[model samples]
Target: APFAAPRGMVATWVGHATVLVQAAGLNILTDPIWSDYASPLPPFGPKRAAQPGIKFDDLPKIDLILLSHNHYDHMDLPTLKRLWERDRPKIVTSLGNDTILKAHGIPATALDWGQSVSGAALNGLAPQAVIQCGSYEHCPDYQVHVTRNHHWGSRWGADRNRALWSSFVIETRAGNIFFAGDTGAGDMGWPMQARRYGPIRLALIPIGAFRFWKGQMRSDAHIGPLQAVDVFQRLGASTAIPIHWGTFRLSYEQWDTPPRMLELALRCAGIARKHFAPLRIGQSLPVPTVSAVPIGPKRCDDRAIRALE
Candidate 1:
């Protein structure tokens, strides 16, 4: 069931926060979860409303994996184990989560905010200053950067925030892509920090699980449609794809509400509807490269960008 790889940047929303990003000749999966339920127990917890877009066996060779956090829905151990045994892809996650994976016998590279791991380790060839492939020529060393996000992580109720959570900015030959793992609008400054990476080509952002108790309980760890637009505008990505919705019923909002709200929010924000793509499960869309003219004015001070580099 392997589909032909897109020649340029492409993304497929599997479900919830899981997205398959193909770029620079590398196949990367974000917060991969193919389990039937987002629970410790198979029969309990939020069951998947829809099956994963790409069947487990059908996934193309996965070169890398980006684990956003340790939440059950975002970090499914079974799926990780399966991919590990089959593909042995390099898994990148925020700090402390590596311990969780190590206990399960999965090796991962854990990074703190602003840290990154290169692709040379996963190339299966001798370390080289530059790795050339048919899909990417003169590609900069593929890098997965761990960036801070406004989110908490825990498996059990008592151990909240035991592991740091993160979003990722992947530097690829196609373009720098941002993956908003799972976050709420915290001070709204984190996205601006991410924007410093500049010229993001594709952004995978969350838009669901925001409406809790009809605003009785503030969703401190998730962003709504309007907030998603805010994040998109801050990141200044060429295209934004909405995720983390319609897969499991994890909040009070009705299923199918996120995408609908996202459309309206885009209109209100005066952003082009095509800029925010809400893909259905099992659907894949091409990611356009960054334009010659950047999306927004560069905000990162020259010194800050250099420091990040």
Candidate 2:
């Protein structure tokens, strides 16, 4: 049976950066890609070790799509076309990305960093229609804020940075939701930008692909477990589920290194492991509305850091 919509918030990790977020009477997807190989050429490039958590056919009527960038791994054209043809969901992406989609006959709204679009525009209905709809909370309107993140974008070799990459903050009556779309710990201040939107009830953070050299815990292009914990604390997120790991091999770390290191990092920071957890693919869970309780900053001991090696 197709999944029914939820009145509150429920999230399902499909794999990689794909997550199905059901909240505020909407079904949202983040950087969705269901291709077996994360590449432009079929049967080439990095192949997925596991299938998508929720089959593409089983996805509910998608109300919105949060496309982070134009990378092949993040932006699979076939999947996007199928989705656009089927549901005609409101697709939101950063600057220059809309052109890429337009060429493929998929319409998307482009926004720069710090810009936002209200739910009225997302519904594809006239403002007057939305006002008269008389649904819950005035048709359960929400806002999508395009926030800045440190990441590059390119489909081929020479067109790097032509499109801006971004993260998003979805504001709703229930609570705000932050999707940290494919970011690195650049100056470590982006999380606070998302925090300013309001209390974040749920956060989707990345904790993988940070290792390239052996024993390298962090990367200029990605955040490992240690930096992820810092991001979670700085953002003051109520609860987070780790993504971008255990689905595809993008880095040199062990298969379980990201989650294991995350557990260790959480312990070192004196936070409960459940606060930032890893979920099995295809798992769905409700997110409780939480007050804004910011975890104060703390440095993990050196011995704990040494154990990560």
Candidate 3:
């Protein structure tokens, strides 16, 4: 794992939707699951196509955990229990997910779509001027806003949407970070909700598990690379890393298709490829603080639109 970025930001793809985000002197984890199978039963469900990029035991000391929803793939009870025992990190998730965690004796803070929680050090304060943080052994201060996303949740088939689904806007001294848990292109306006928090330095967007049928690029439940580029532009993110692909066999597309399509989408949208990097599992990339100018909706020519079809 990369060393924590004390005054900057660094992110490592741990596989699937799991990302080890080192920012604001805190070691934050998103949808961390180290299980071999994303199912209620072992040796069944979606078996991992690749092992965890960072071994469970080798993870840095975690300060915060962002649990997006209750999908088996995103919320593995065994891993959560282990992390709770070892690191005692502050686990934050959408409503009703806390009930699930509570049943397993894991404490977590639950928030609604527009609610937020700040670290103890911040005393529930709003984001302030950026700080020049040096090396520190503990989290300085931060805020996590539970933002809206177009997704539903159900561990079993019957309890869909009992718990809310959401993205998150993490406010830190370094910069704001957006984590789009798992979502589809709903009104394409949710990204702007996160952007309202502040300029996003790094956005972790899902760009796979969208193809439910042959030749299908997107679905009501997930966004493909084309929609993901639109999301990136809408949020005005300085940089983004694609997730939810190449880890588990969840969709019909080839394992390598999402990133390839993302490359194409970036070119079609006239955005630089480096802004939306797709890293190898366990690869770490330093996030640079860049100016985030608001961009309008994408307008690809007829030929460009047909090429994505």
Candidate 4:
């Protein structure tokens, strides 16, 4: 298809942390990691049970790519290479990952969180500064601004906190969308994406890969189903499409547990199924035009968020 504004953005959950977000006449892929195993080695690391919903070859024309962080799941080098080879679409991600991409021959533009970069997919939205509260200076490579998140970001070895990892509040004229890479639900900024970035029409959030390794639940890794709901409400998203679940069993939760738990969370909160519909792998959903659906707000308490314990 010839390039055009995404009449509206449609999110197709390919699996794990990878998602295909088509918006503003642009087919934008977020962390397009289509590899069978999310590891540096082909047979090691985690394996996926379900295949990618949209085969690499069958993808619509990709205009842009968003990478939230550089964890292998969100920044698979092999997948990025394939995308670069196939479409050569412009890629956007956090800094340092550009080195990885360039190493793979994928020319990409990397940005820190809160930084705003716009093109056709953004619906003609312009660049905007982000609300930040961190010790690190925002990298200069991006045309966008960088904001802080309550998560950890480190690609390799001792430099875990050297480079910042964060969520994005993308501001486009058509609407705003928040893409939370892999993050736990402990931070206050989790909800601020909507308040700070404007109205969040769509949220591509992480809803899986939360492991209970070592008995103590890690607050910086990723959030579970209930926490995902908290993120939706916090971000003031009109509607939400759940990702990072059902594709691969990255954590201890049953492969199908995330969705079932998500429904239960919504039900407990008194939210209608329509308010936060979780898409099937590779399935697409439209961005909700209505902000704050009429579905009465559900009773999501901090206790419920803590229930993941």
Candidate 5:
């Protein structure tokens, strides 16, 4: 896009579900995980195949941090603490995760579904570019709402469902965005969420780490390309960007399968290939965004159309 990025809003894809969103002149991060490994250890478990796109020092000034859940891949304590110590961005997340961040000196605020913080214009700061929480989760003033996904939520304990797992319905001057942290094909809650927060301007949905355990491990956790397309249609969103792929081989599919399949499925659905994107790691796309060309019916002019079948 040739337009200058106005101070009102902007969103950048860091890697995985981690995104850098600028709204109302505020730089915000969503489900930021910068650690080398998505595990409790340093040398074992799923290690990141690609290096982080946003270096710690090079990150723009951050004013807010939105954590979607407690999964290690979604929430990294070390990364959170670093951001907290440097910028002290206000942390907004589901219930109980406040405790998790607080343990790391993050001083997070918790919110439940249907609850939210009041809207405000850019002030540059509470005195210094900081937004304060309106009230507690159970309070009537909170403005954030929680939505469900066909995914599980747990962190460092056996208490699954103990902490509320959800996605965010963010209303900015730019537009409304639905951030689906991590979810599976069944997506137990998006339909209801779409009914509530439907017509989202942009949807940041998960698209990888799904295989083998499609019915057991992450059985209800991750979605493949077709299911991802369903998510895009379910929300009635303007644009859908696929994440959670190619960064780590957490699933049984080939490393290159996601983008290829996503393109194929988008075609099969008669949706334009550009509408459903699998962006390169660390790259950003201007949202409320669309395809470059007007997509047409499958022309038998090339092998591209044949691959869709």
Candidate 6:
């Protein structure tokens, strides 16, 4: 599928954890993988259950790429190389991952949790003194913050946690966006840390591949629908779009299970269904601008709100 260039603050779910975010006049891709398989080998491992929402050639000029971890599914080297050669987008990932990317001829800036890197430096642009405001044309300075999440990173059998795993908090001119690369509900307080950065306008959270051994698995590395909603509430985001599902058969759950379960979870949590979106493989939606006006009280049932209390 080919995507039209989105004008303002917009996001497109290109399957799995891959999302295309167009905001602040810059285009960003999250955990982009357009390969046929999310495996170490081309012919083996988890083959993509569906094609990427937007074709590679159809992508607009990408300003940055966000990598959450080193899993083959999330870090497809072939696609990364292609994008690097084509768009020369600045790549950001957790610490220790930069060495891996550098060895593969792709340069990236690696940061530890709570550390941040500016897009201007990443894109090789010199710092400017004047602020020329026009649609993203002036290349507004953006900041990508490496934040903590409950996840592990490993590309091979012997290298577990050799590279750090994390989520990202992107502060753009339009608003703040949180991209949970891949995370489990760890301590239930990790999401709260993001709140200090300010109100989150959009949240991209994982909501699939959680069922293991019929619930026997600890699921300490991936989050399901219920936990996703919990993370959403913790961040106090204005809108939430569920990702990391329905693109690959990584678990025992059915292809349509995540969204269906997410709907049930949202209803049970007393959150308005409109606040949570389950986008199609190639769907793009405009994000609401963050406003200073206070939001009115939610319409959730008192009983539903009390359940969390």
Q: Pick the candidate with the highest lDDT.
A: 3
State the lDDT at 20 in candidate 6: 93
Model 5 TM-score (2 dp): 0.81
Q: Which stretches of candidate 6 lie over 4 Å from their true place?
A: 1-7, 125-135, 216-218, 291-309
Q: Count clashing residue pairs in model 2.
A: 0
- Model 2 segments beyond 4 Å from truth? 1-7, 126-129, 136-140, 292-303
Alpha-carbon TM-score of each model against the true structure:
0.88, 0.93, 0.91, 0.81, 0.81, 0.90
Q: Clash pairs of candidate 3?
A: none
By summed lDDT, which 10 consecutive residues of candidate 4 come out lowest?
133-142
User: If both were scored by lDDT, which would come out higher, candidate 1 or candidate 2?
Assistant: 2
Q: For residues 1-309, could you state the per-residue lDDT of candidate 5 as single tens digits?
A: 112154234556788888887654546688888898988877887898888777878887676677888888888899998888898777778888888777777787788766666433222223212234432211112124566666677865777877777777776545567788777756355645644754566678887776664333234678777678777777777777787877765778778777787777776667787666777767766665422334467433347555533
Question: Which tens-of-lDDT digit does each residue in 1-309 have in candidate 6?
Answer: 233343347889999999998886778899999999999877889999889999899999888899999998899999999999998888999999999999999999999999988766775666672145344555658889999999998889899899999999999877899999999988988788877788998899999999887643229999888799889988988888999998988898779878877776787767766678799899987887664323344545676455322
The predicted structure with the larger TM-score, 2 or 4, is 2
Candidate 3 vs candidate 4: the TM-score winner is 3
**Evaluation by lDDT, superior candidate among 2 and 4:** 2
Worst 10 residues of 5 by lDDT: 134-143
Query: What is the per-residue lDDT of model 3 for residues 1-309, given as tens digits with 9 covering 90 to 100?
Result: 776455689999999999999986788999999999999988989999999999999998998999999999999999999999999988889999999999999989999999998875333332342244334443357889999999889998799889988999998878889999999998988999888998999999999999998889799889999999999988989999999999999989989889988987887777777889899998999998967544344556787677678
Q: What is the lDDT of candidate 4?
A: 0.68
**Worst-scoring 10-residue span by lDDT in model 2:** 291-300
The lDDT of each candidate is 0.83, 0.85, 0.88, 0.68, 0.68, 0.84
- lDDT tens digits, residue span 1-309, model 2: 124344478889998889998886778899889889998887988899889999999998888899999988788899999999999888999999999999999999999999999888766566777668766435647789999888889999899899999999998766788988888889888999989998888999999999999768888778888888898888898889899998888899988889989988987787877778898988886886776544445446787678776
Best by TM-score: 2
Q: Is candidate 1 or candidate 2 better by TM-score?
A: 2
Report the Cα lDDT for candidate 1.
0.83
